[model samples]
Target: MMMPAAPETDAVRLREAMTESLKTSGALDDPAWRAAVAAVPRHRFVPGFYLPAQEPDEHGLTVWEPVTADADYGRWLAAAYSDRTLITQFDEQEPDWAAPRVRHGGTPTSSATLPSLVLRMWADAGIAEGHAVLEIGTGSGYSTALACERLGSAGITSLDADPKRLETAATALHSCGYTPTLAVADGWYGYWPEAHFDRVVAVCSFRAVPPALIAQTRPGGKILLTLSGWMYGYARVLLTVSGDGTAEGTLLPGTVSFMSARSHAAPAFGNPAHWVAGLPEKARPVRHGPERITAATAEAFHLRYLAQCAVPDAQLTTFEDTVVLVDVVSGSAASLTPRGPGWDVREAGPVRLWERIEGVLDAFDASGRPGPGRFRLCVRGDEQFLSHPRLPSLPLPSVGYGRASTTGPSASRRMPGSGR
Candidate 1:
């Protein structure tokens, strides 16, 4: 009698399926990237992860259910190869890998970033054979595996702030036969021992490009990262390091959000009432009529980016039809609501939050509401400035205009006065 043919392992079949899906979705266009995806077993890296349940629990928190291969191989394998982010840690706590279920109330501290996004960033980094890459935030080592496949193991160095994450990534990478340099250190300070990387890619978002990254990158090296701000506005940025240590680049035409680096994470904000109470005694109303601009609108996305660039630490909260702006450090607060023909504006705080916003909105309007791609970033040492070729570079403090070109017509125009 002929024996039945042996069944293929679920991990192998799933990985192949995932590779095909990625190619079909146009996410794995590069043959090498596709091969990398196929070669590495993602299931091994993420043994257990939390998935949001359809219904939340009694505490008004989303119920995160744990999934493991032992209990249910099908679901686990499906999730492993699926193009979705898997939360590996919550509130800096790693969930029990063997637990059948668990609930997490804290924010996601670490995760395996979506595969498509990882490939996109990798493609943008322009990693070629023999290129030495320094990867920041080696969360799951999935990206590291891909880089290793493209560039040999000797050409990759991955760093993470969390020691636990580093340990986990090292094991996963080794299991996949990749022995990239893994270090437990702050990503803000690029691994100095191994300097002069051909490319630097940050998996986490940053308010500003770390000077160390620029210093460690070889001239003409590319740096890919997601630049985010207090408003939660994010844009993918690709910068080319210059010989003088200054890097300049334009914002790519897309939106990407990632967890902030642990070291650079924003401080927790106190009660909003405290900020509102600290406002100046005098109250004011805005002159402009009710505008359609808002944080949710597509066109306003770039405006939000500009707003965050102007006030790096400002926080925005929206409810119903009103938008509340608060700066914890400066103790400034402003509430703008639609009333009658114009917005009812309330201002309190030393920072003149409403007036600052008004000036930014006016500037945005004057510029015909340009897209985020029009914005350019110039990094000189620790200071980074965002400007438009058509508009004067607005240094951080002015909150209005930047240095104007003498020869050519100035994109810098006088900001409209704030209505008191």
Candidate 2:
């Protein structure tokens, strides 16, 4: 592959913006991370060309980038540095491959995740000087670069499932002057070359803590991961590797959405029989707006918590007229059933998922609205616990998301399940 022409001006602007933003976000406080973020030009790794548009009041966000255009490349480079997410893969269009691949708006296989979240994970990992770090999912080597900048090249090993992505990352890292060990392998398996490390960071989501991850860490090592559980949403968990390789940590503030590791890809949609057998008990049937909750609760931390509880197999499916969320494990489903007045929730399963959720809301209601400050999380082995200042805070008896229940035979549209 030919090296794309450099955009010096764009790189300068990105460096300024990122430096300022990191300063404001306190990410610049650490000299190593500051130098790393400042030294790396976000544009060099992303060679795409983004089209721009204007709106009445606000500018249209650079939604997608053309991978091969040289003239309009600045936008791509700018976005690469900005806090925005740069989608690196969608369906068959691998950004590392040749250009003109038709893009879809469905799932994202890889991305340089938002900067704030990136720093948050880095801080959560608690890496000290010379700490050996193993990173899962080396997308574009952006985070890997940051790790190298912090841990140095000899202490970092980054892995990804796709060889193409790893190749691109390797090239990008070498060009940027960092040589972390790069491997094309499933992140779930982790890297066995190194038995123990001071830190482990997973940029992807997992159904549960993998045994391999735990086994790879030495006692007292910290494992930073985005865990799926049954709390308010998905949480960034900071776990301490135990002597026996088992680890546990409390949920941190903030949220992130990540592609699940390839080895633990979400399962297929449900059949009527399967749904019937997996129904959540005590669930009530009602109409509610599914999109409202989905958008408001896009926090990966909370989603991960819920997945750990009520609906371990919960997935979100959005359609033209309806938004569906199903907990296949509990045979429960929640749909934003449209009514004349507005959208109400129609939920059915073994447990009254809405009532249980309302129970949490009610606790919040009783306590007034408890913000993040009032929230406290505690975890013990498989038992993860949470409490906040608010209404109906129930000690979640299970670990999962509440599923969307559907029983009607007249249903028309449906798609694959989204494992939260």
Candidate 3:
């Protein structure tokens, strides 16, 4: 009779299968990355993670259930090696796999990103041999292990905001025989001791590429991350740092997103009625449909991205065919509703919120409507902005914007990849 394959042997086989799947999916093309994926056992990092259960909670939000290795070894290993993103922590709560209770509803605060996407970012960031890398948001340490496998532990420095996560990631890395440098600090502030890395890559999302990251990178080094906004739009950005403390690059083609840095996420905006009550009674008709600007359609996705560059802190809300954008801190608000052929809008507050959004969409149209490929990013000293050759350079929103608060319904958004 044939002997049963050992658990570790099974892991090797599953890891190899995942590598092949990524190859076929076009998420990975480099032979070095393929080898890294084949060698590391991802199950070591996420022995237990959460998956969205089919059932919705009483509030109609997604309910999450844990998939622990102890509960179901076969299923757990399979999911760990699968291409899907595995959520490891929720609402900043450290998950207790032993208990394995069903979570009614909570935001995903940490996750092991989709396997294929992790490898893709490795390739996209152009981290080659002998290059020292500073990896931001060491959530699972899976990516760090992959880097250590090819680049070696001595040159890879991984950082995360939570001390608990860094401790957990350090343990996982040690199990994988990696002793890469691990630091605990907010990714926005960046790790300072190990400055001037060859590459700086963030798995987390940001409103703008933090100046600290640019300051930490070597003169010729590259910085890769996704720029996100309260509007729920995301775009891939890669830039080369300069000697004068600046970086410039264009948006990479294809869709991309990531969980916002906790400090960078949108603040709760209280009640809609309160803001709506402040708007003017009369409304003005506009040329374009509100759907074109606010809908989740593929056509409008990039349009929202443009609007985000114009006004990063502008939060979106929609109800009963009416769409509104609010600059809560600046006391700006606008509401739009469908009219005969176009839409009618009412504006209020200091900033002309709707007018700015409408102007951006119009400018984009006048420039032959270049796709996301035409988008450019430039970071200069304290200011960061997006610029197009034909259009004006739009400055990113300033940080520390305040919000009004009152009990209210949750705003609707179309953020993909539940979170990290």
Candidate 4:
């Protein structure tokens, strides 16, 4: 008897892989998600490019060209549509209009967010049948397809700032025989002309909630978006727009990275090396500190200081030998490096930023027992007020406008709040 034929192509293998992922993730029963995943031809959505496999090195990870072939189209397709994120934009934007090139494993600007995460976020928003949903950030339009499939054509509107991406997505949708109102506009504005949406979903992340978003959403509507700039991980917030024009929601457990909306795109941190060159000459190392704490707690502590310090821009990245922090405010960046047995701060101005962050964590530890239940978020219009169970709201101290907190004497205070 002839044996069963081997898996013939990448697309075939991809289907099997995705099927297996569904089985293991317990997402098979999700009909809307299954239908959306199956209906969208993922191959059509990807560009003709692939990221090189990573090679670990002494300095850091290095990237080399990925072996590409005809079947690679299917591998890319499967990866693009899988239950994980596929980075689509790097450094700043799409590298090439047609094919993206992989450089130093730089920051991702856009991507196809994980399918399961998208589905859960959509479900969490409580999108109902025939509900008018306003989807902000139409990255590849894969999520928009899912939205259209769930809400139907007449009730959904999707917006994106990148006109080229929109055009590509429109074509892909037409090929799949589905169409929704696609607009080329800054999603941060929330397409106010089409207000009163039952659900507002931002596929991208934001530093603060936009006023237009609150105004456009109908009272009692659901607003699901990512509250970004977290030290450890971004929180997926499910908010309910209240009758009083304010919204509040608990943070979901899952964490996912996303492109910041164009209007809220992070400003550049000037000359990364400059910060490295300005190391403080008299800094001492602090002993007795632990190496690996809960990533969540670590991130939260960092975010707390960022908010309280009134720093306009700060970025944190960890390495085997060091944890590097780059702070850019008023177009100048201060680099702080924490290495084995010692700490160094490099900048033209305040040099104790790193110590201030560490101190915040220590103070929180001193509070005895502050945990998840203690963390809180409150935003009204352009102001955000944060308080933990044991801590109270205080004024945000200024530190050379657009900088992170480096001072140690200020009372528990609020920083420049978000404009939401």
Which candidate should be chosen as best, given TM-score against the real structure?
A: 3
How many pairs collide in each candidate, listed in order? 3, 71, 0, 9
User: Judged by lDDT, which candidate is best?
Assistant: 3
Taken over the whole model, the C-alpha lDDT of each candidate is 0.75, 0.60, 0.80, 0.58
RMSD of each: 10.5, 9.7, 7.4, 9.0
Q: Model 3 over residues 1-420: C-alpha lDDT tens digits?
A: 222346577788888888888889887678888888888889889977998988898888888888876677787788888999999998898977778788887888899999778887888889888787988889998998999998888888887787777778888888778888777767776666666678999999988777777777889899999888898888888899999889998988766678888889888887877888789999998756666655766557777778877777689888557787888678888888877778899998878787888788888889998887787888886678888989998887655322211112112221121111
Consecutive 10-residue window with the lowest summed lDDT within model 3? 411-420
Please tell me which model should have the higher lDDT, number 2 or number 4: 2
Question: Which one wins by lDDT: 1 or 3?
Answer: 3
Model 3 segments more than 4 A misplaced: 1-6, 293-299, 340-342, 400-420
lDDT of 3 at 19: 86
Q: Over 4 Å off in model 2, which ranges?
A: 1-13, 49-63, 67-71, 92-98, 101-104, 229-233, 268-292, 295-308, 318-323, 327-420
lDDT of 2 by residue, 68-106 (tens): 434435445656778766677764246543445433234
lDDT: worst 10-residue window of model 4: 411-420
Residue lDDT tens for model 1, 1-420: 221233136678888998999999999999989988988888778877888989877866898888777666677778989999999898887666766557746789999888998999899889999788989888988888888877778888888887777778778877778888877767766776667789999999887777777888899999998877666767678999999989988888765789988755667776665555554555456865324334366666656666676666678776457677787777677877776666777776667666766677777778877787788888886467888755556543221122222123222111122000
Give all TM-scores, in the order shown.
Answer: 0.86, 0.73, 0.90, 0.76
In candidate 4, residue 320 scores what lDDT? 44
**What lDDT is obtained when candidate 1 is compared to the true structure?**
0.75
